[model samples]
Target chain A: MTTVFKRPESLKDTETHYCSGCGHGIVHRLIAEVVDELGIRERVVGIAPVGCAVLAYEYFNFDVSEAAHGRAPAVATGMKRARPDLIVFAYQGDGDLAAIGMAEIIHAANRGEHITVFFVNNAVYGMTGGQMAPTTMLGQKTETTPRGRNALGEGAPIRVAELLAQFDGVKFVERCTVSKPRNVLKARAAVKTALSLQIEGKGFGFVEILSPCPTYWGLQPRVAMRMIEERMEEIFPLGRIKEPAAEG
Target chain B: MAEKHLMCGNEALSEAAVAAGCRCYFGYPITPQNEVTAYMSRRMPEVGGQFVQSESELAAINMVFGAAVVGARAITTSSSPGISLMQEGISYIAANELPAVIVNVMRGGPGLGNIGPSQADYFQATRGGGHGDYRTIVLTPASVQEIVDHVILAFDLADRYRNPVLILIDGVLGQMVEPVEIAPPPAADLPAKDWALTGCKGRPPNKSRSLILGENELLEMNRRLQEKYRAIEAAEARHEAVDAADAEILLVAYGSPARTCRSVVRKYRERGYRIGLFRPVTAWPFPSAALAECAKGASAVLVVEMSAGQLVEDVRLTLGPAANVLLLGKPGGEVIQAGELEAEIDRIIGLHKMKRR
Candidate 1:
C-alpha cells in the first residue's frame, strides 16, 4: 500500500481554531512541510504573533514563543542571536508587521539578523472584526472604512516586500499568494527558500504571503481566492521582489 | 579588575551584569541611564556577549524577552519614558514567568518629565506597572557597591523564581561614582531551566505564552500565579533596620533617599532624638512584616521618598490607626535633604510632647 499524502511531522495532528476558508491553515501546513523538508524541525524556534494565528504554537510541533503585538521581529532576533544554532522565524500578520511593528521589522532587516520572517498580508484585520489594515487597498471597505478607504484620508496600501528589499541587510524578499494551487506551490517554494537562507546563515529573508480572509473581505471562500488573484494581485504584484546576493 | 577602584553607578551595574552570566543586553539610549547602554556596547564584545542598541525600548525589552525565552541571561536598561514604553513587554514577561533583568534608572516623569532623578515610579514598579495582576521583584540599591551586588542577585532571583526582577534606581544611584568591590560569581549553580525554549530536540515542544481564553483555565492560572507570589513574599522580603529597636521615631525609606534618612538618623540620635531608619531592599515583597513589627514601639513612622507620596500609602496600610504615619516625599527629581527631614522630625516630636502633657 502506498501513502503518498499525509500530514507533515512538523505539524501537530489536531484541530485548529482558524475560521472557515481562511488561508492560515494552508500557510501553516506549508511551513511545516518546509521545516520537515529541510530537516530543521528540531532546531527551529518559531514566534507567534498577536493575531488570528496567535495559537500557532499549538499547531507547530516545535518550540515557539508568543510575542506582544508587533514585536515578533525583535523577539526572533533575540532567539537567533542568543543561539545561532537554532533556526528562528516569526509568523506575523499585516497588522503585526506593517503597522505597529514597522520599526521592529525594518530594524531587524536593517541589522541583518540571521532569521526568517513569514508575513501574511490579508489586507484587513481579520481577528479584530475586519478593521482597515495598513495593507488594505485604497478603495477597499472595512469595519473602520465604512464608506471605503480613501487615499486622501487613510493612505494607500503598503508594499512590504519592496520596502524591505531596499535594505542591504536583507538577503531575500519575495511576495507570493496562495490564491490558486499553482500560486500556493510558488509560495511554498518561496517559504522553503527563505528557511534555506536562514540555514545557510544568510541574513534576513522575508516572504510576504498575500493570503485570503473571506470573512473579513465579505466574500465567499471561492470568491475571496478569486479576488486575491484579481484585485489584490493587481495592487500587490507577486514574484521575487529581491534575490539573495550571489555567492562569490 | 582592580580590587577596589572608582566606578560609575551605571557602568559598574553593567559590569556586574556581565559577571553574573548575562550575555545578551538590549537597550535604548536614555538620559541618566545612557551610561548603562554605553558601557554595555563597549563591555559586551570584550566578554564575548551580545549587545544590541534596539530601535526603541519596546524592541529592547522584547529582545530581552526573546533572549530569556531561550534560557539566555538577558537584560535591558532604560529611564522613565523608555521604561514606560517597555511596560507592554514587561507585563508579558512577568505573566509568562520568563527570567530577565530590567534596569530602570528612573528620571522625573508624569509625561516626558525631565532628565533628573526621581523615585515616582515606586508604585509603577511595586504594583506591576502595566495592566495585570502580576508582580515584579523590584530591588532598590542605595549605592554603587550595592548596585554591583544587587544586579548579580537580581539575575539569580529572576531565574530561581522564573519571573522578571527589576533593578530600580534613579539618577542619584545610577550616576553616582564611588569605590565598589566587584565580587566573584557565587559558588551556587544557577537552577536548570527545564522549561526553556531551546528547541524541542528529543523532547516535547515548549510553548511560552500568556493567552488563556478559557474562563476557568485563566482563573486557575491566576490562582497558581498568586500562590507563587505568596511563596515569594514568604521567602524574599528584605530590609535593613538601623538602630530601630527602642527608638521613638522610625524612618522608612529606599534608594538614595534612604542615605539621607540614614544621615538624619545618625545626626538626630546624637541630639537626644531616638530616630531610626528602615530601608526596604526588595520593594515588591516589601518587608511588610518586618516593617509592621519595627513600627510597634516607635512614636511615629516617617517615610522619606524621592516621590511625592507613593510609599506613604503602603506605610499607612501597614500601620493603620495603630501608629502615626508621616510622609516627607520630595518630587521633581530632587533628593530629599537631611536638614529638611531633621526639622520635620523635631516638629513631630514637639507635637507628641504637647499631646502627652
Candidate 2:
C-alpha cells in the first residue's frame, strides 16, 4: 500500500555483475544512497579499483574513472587536487588496498588529501579466483593458500582500518559491515559521515566495510553472511577506529 | 617578457613546466631528477598549483594519471629504476589515452646501476616498456635549453594528441647548468577537454577506462589506438639533420650522445671529411623517414650510443639492408667520448676503403 523501498537515483538501473549474495551490491547501494542523500551526485567523482568492483563506474550515476589495480587512492588524490570543487572517492577491495596498493593507500592517507576512501575488505581476493589476499584471515583457505592461511608463513591478516587509524593525517576512520540490516544501516551512516567530512574539507576519511565474498569463501550467500557476523568480525572488530579531536 | 637565467637542466625544465600551465606535479625523489621534484614542490604551491612528493614512483605516476583524467596538465619525474617502477601507471595512462607529461632523467640501470648519465633507456622509452600495445611520445632533449624547450613542447604535444609524452634526458643534462632563455608560454590553442571526468553535472555520466573484456570491444579499442599512433608517426616525427646533403658518413645519435657527436662531426668537417650529424628529437616516432632521406647521400650510418646497440637497431630498421648501419656503443656507465667516437668513425671509414679496393 505504501511505497517505501526503491533504488536510489544515484544508482543506475543496469544489472550488476556481482555474484549472488555478494556484499559488493550492498556496499554499492549504501554508497549510492549516501550520494543521493547528500545531493552531490552531480559533483561526485568516483574512482573504481581493479578488483571485483572494476566495473563500478557502470553502476554509479556519476563520472567514474577506473584506476589500475591498487592505484585508486593515488588516482583519487589526483582528482581532488586537480578539481577541489568536486567530491572524489576511491572504492577498493582488500587486495587492491592492502597488498600491491599498500604504498598508495598509506601515502595518500598520510598526505591528508581531502578525499574519501570506501575500502571493501572481504578478507580474500574475490576477483582473481579467491587468491590469498593480505587481509586473508589466518587458517582461512584460499586458492593461493589451499592448505589454509598459515600464520607462520603467510603472516597475519592485515587490519587496514587499525593501520590507517594510526596515521595523523587521517581525520576519521571507521570499520563497519553489511552482514545484517542493522549493520548495513551502520555502514550507510559511516559512509555518509565520511562523505560529510570530505564536504567540510576536514581531511582524509576512510570507511572499511567488512563485506561478504560467498564465491571466494566457498560458502552459500547466507552462510558467508553468517561467517562475517561470527568469525570475520572477531578478526576485524567493528566501530570507529579514529576521529578528529574537538575544536577548543 | 622572456626571462633568462643560468639554471640547472632539471630546474629549467620545472620552470618551463609551470610556464606551460602544468598545475599539478607528482614526483618522488630520485637521483639527478630530484631537483625537478624539489623545484616543483616549492614553485607549484606558489602559483596556486598542487605538488605532491609521492611516497614512491608508483604512486606519483598514478597521481598523474588521476590529474590527467580531469583534464589538468600534470607531470611526474623519475630516474631509470624509478621509471621502471612507474611502468605500470604509464601503461595505464597510455591505454586510457590520458594526457600527462613524464620526465625520465635516466641513469645507468639493469638494476640500480649508478647515478651517472646514460641513454640505456632509449629502447625502453621508444618501445613500450610496460605491457600492452601502446606507445608514448618520447622526446630526447640534449641540452638545458632543449630541456626547457621540450618540456613546454611535451605538454603541448601530450594535450594535442590526448596521450602521454615522455622527455627522456640523462643525469648530465639534468645536473648540468646553462644560461637558457625561457620562452613565453606558447599561444597554441588546444581543444576543450569535454571528455574529461570532471563530473556528469548536466550530461550523462562519462566513464574513463582501459579494460575491455569483450574480444570485439578490445579489438576496436586497439584499432583506435593504432590509428592515433599512425597519425602521430606521420605528423610528429622530429629530427635535426646537419650537413646531410653530401656527407660521406652520417652519424646517428640522440640525447647526450647527440651533443657529443655534434662536436665530433664539426671537428671532422673542419678537416674536410664529409661527415654529418642526425639527431632524433622525437624518439618514439623514431623519425624513420627523415633518417632514411638523410642516409641516402651517405655511404654508411654510424649510430653512437651509451647503450649496447639499442638505438642502432632502430637505425638498421629505418635504413634497411642496403644501407651500411654500424653501431659504436660504450656500455656499463661509460659516456661515449668524442675522441673514441672519432676513432671508431675513422676505423669504419678505413674498413670501407679497404673493401672498396
Candidate 3:
C-alpha cells in the first residue's frame, strides 16, 4: 500500500474556518501544494488581507502577516523590498483588491514590485453579507443591490486581470476558476506559474481566481459553482491575459 | 565625534535613522517633510538599504508595517494630513506590537490648512489617534539636533518595547537649517524578535497579527497591552527642567514652543525673576509625575502651546490645582513670540497679586 493522497505538508492539519463550498479552502490548498512543490515553504511570507480569507495566516504553515483592508500589496511591497531573499505574496479578495485597495494594488504593480498577488473575485462581498462588490455582475442581485446591480448607478464590474495586465510592471496576469475539475487544474497551474515568475525575480505576477461565495450568493454550493461556469466565466473569461517576455 | 555639519531637521533625521540601523524606509511626499523623503531616497540606496516612494501615506505606513513584521528597522514620515491617512496603519502597527518609527512634521490642520509650522497635532499624536486602546511612544523634537537624536531613540524604544515610536516635530523644525553634530548610532542591545514573521525554518510558523476575533482573547490582549504601557510609563517618562527649583513662576511647553520658552526663561532670569521652564520630551507618556514634581515649588504655572490648549489639559490634570495653571495659546500657524509670552506671564502675576490683596 502506498500513501498516494494526503494533505499537503505546507497546509496545517487543523480544519479551516472558511464556509463550506467557499473557494478559499481549495485555493489555499492549491497555494500550499505549490509552495511545497517548489520547496520554498521555509522562504515564503504570505500576506493575508482584511476579507473572508483574513484568517489565512492560520491555515498556511509558512510565515504570514495580516494586513489592513486593501493594503496587502503595500505590505507585500515592504516585505519584498526589505528582504529580497524571501518570496512574498499577497492574498486579496475582490472588494479588497478592486475597491478599497485600488490605490495600493495599482501603485505596487506600477512600481514593478517583485511579488505575487492572489486575487479572489467572488462577485459579492462574502464576509460582509452579500454586498455589491466592484466585481459583482451587472444583473447580480446582492443584498445592497436588491433590484440587481445597475450599471448606470453602480457601474460595470471591474476586469481586474485585464486592467492589471496593461501595467508595464506586471509581468504575468492570468484569470482562472475552480468551479470545475478542469478549471481547478488550470487555476492550480496558474498559481504555480505566478509563484515561479516571482521566484525567477520577474516583476509582479497576478493570478485572479473567480471563486464562489455560496453563502452570500443565495444559492446552493453546487449552484454557486455552476454560476461560475455559466455566468461568471462570460464576464471574466478564463485565460492568461498577460505573459512575461521570453528569455534570449 | 563627528564634525558639526549644517543640515535641515529632515536631513538630520534621515541620516540618524540610517545610523540607528533603520535599513528600510517607505514614505510619500508631503509638504514640510518632503525633504526627508528625498534625503532617504538618496541616502538609503547608498547605505545598501531600501527606500520606496509609496503611492500614499497609507501605503507607506503599511509598507513600514510589513518591513517591521519581518524584524527590519523601518520608518515612514508625513505631515499632518498625511499622518491622518496613516493613523489606520499606525493603529495596526501598535496592536501587532511591531517596532517601527513614524515622523510627523506637523502643519496646520482640520483640513489642508497650510504648509506652515503648527503644533495642532498634539492631541492626535498623543491620544491614540487610531482605533483601539493602544498607545505609541511619542517623542517631540525641538531642534535639528534633537530631531536627529530622537529618531535614534525612537528606533531603540520601538524595538525595546516592541511598539511603534513616533517623533513629532513642527514645520519650523523640519525645514530649519542648523549646525548639528551627528552622533554615531547608540550601541543599545535589543532582545531577539522571536515573534517576527521571518518564516518557519526549524520551528512552527510565526505570525504577526493584530486581529483578535475571540472575545476573551481580545480582552486578555488589551490587558497585556495595558501592563506593557504601565511598564513603559514607569521606565521611560522624560522631561527637562531649566532652573525649576525656587522658581516663583513656571512655564510649561514642548517641541518648538519649548525652544522659545527656553529663551524666554533666560531673559526673565536675567531680570532677577524666578521664572523657569518645563519641557516634556516624551509626549505620550506625558511625563506627568515628573512635571508635577517640577511644579511643586512654583507659585503659578503657565502652559504655552502652538495649539489652542491641547497639552494644557495634561498639565492641569497633573497639577490638579496645586498651582494656578494658566494657558496661553497661539493657534492657526501663529508662532508664539517671547514678548507675548512675557506679557502673559506678567498679567498672570498681576492677577495673583490682586488675589493675594
Q: Order of candidates by DockQ, top first? A: 1, 2, 3
- The whole-model C-alpha lDDT of candidate 3 against the native structure comes to 0.91
Tens-digit lDDT track of model 1 for A1-248: 99977999999999999988899999999999999999998889999999999999999999999999999999998888788899999999999999999999999999999999999999999888999999999889999999899988799999999999999999999999889999999999999999999999989999999999999898999999999988998999999989987876
For candidate 1, give the lDDT. 0.92
In candidate 2 the C-alpha lDDT for residue A209 amounts to: 96
Candidate 2, B141-244: lDDT as tens digits:
88999998999999989989999999999888999999998876758888778889887889998889988988699999999999999999999999999887
- Candidates 1 and 2: which is better by lDDT? 1
Lowest lDDT 10-mer window, candidate 3 chain B? B348-357
Q: lDDT winner among the candidates?
A: 1
Q: What lDDT score goes with residue B124 in model 3?
A: 89
Model no. 2, DockQ: 0.88
Residue range B266-292, candidate 1, lDDT tens digits: 887777677788899989898988998
Put down candidate 2 lDDT per residue, A141-242, tens digits, no spaces: 999998999999899999999999988899899999999999999999999999999998989999999999999898999999999989999999999999
Compared to the true structure, candidate 3 yields what TM-score? 0.98
Q: Residue B136 of candidate 2: its Cα lDDT?
A: 95
* TM-score, candidate number 1: 0.98
